[model samples]
Target: MANHKSALKRNRQAAVRNARNSHIRSTMRTFVKQVRTAVATGDQAAANEALGRAVPYIDKAATKGIIHKATASRKISRLAKLVNGMA
Candidate 1:
């Protein structure tokens, strides 16, 4: 419980931000999972397509501070490698 008015406002803001951040993070994970699933299924075309969709989601997540820039780069690199290896 926040005693001060500003603290109460901040708590409310934090709750909203947490929900928004969670959505972004969940979307990012779904994109990444799609790419991985495509790769695992040995569908190069599908994997490439999913990877394409995932890159931007990943970059956006990084840009929005949901994930670290390096982590995003690493994920992109790994996904690319998987897709490339399928060819």
Candidate 2:
């Protein structure tokens, strides 16, 4: 439904970006899930390690505009708290 040529090109670019963003977002969610699973299992060391891995991915996602920076910080904080709370 893109009439102009430039519009068509933009549509194509948007589609590509959408797919890439979706992949990155899915990966971020998976990383978060891993950290949560580790916490749920009460493995403090594993949870810490998973949180370490997850934070970078979250930051990258935020930088890439897939997620908000504050959201990323909040997620990292919550995960760290969960890990810390696991005696």
Top-scoring candidate (lDDT): 1
TM-score of each: 0.96, 0.95
Q: After superposition, how far is residue 51 of candidate 2 from its true place, in Å?
A: 0.8
Q: Residue 68, candidate 1: how far off, in angstroms?
A: 0.8
**Pairing residues by index, what is the TM-score of model 2?**
0.95
| Candidate 1, 1-87: lDDT as tens digits | 999999999999999999999999999999999999998899888998899999999999999999999999999999898889888
Q: Candidate 1: list runs displaced more than 4 Å.
A: none
Prediction 1 global C-alpha lDDT: 0.94
- Point out where model 2 deviates above 4 Å: none
lDDT of 2: 0.93
26-71 per-residue lDDT for model 2 (tens digits): 9999999999999898888888899889999999999999998999
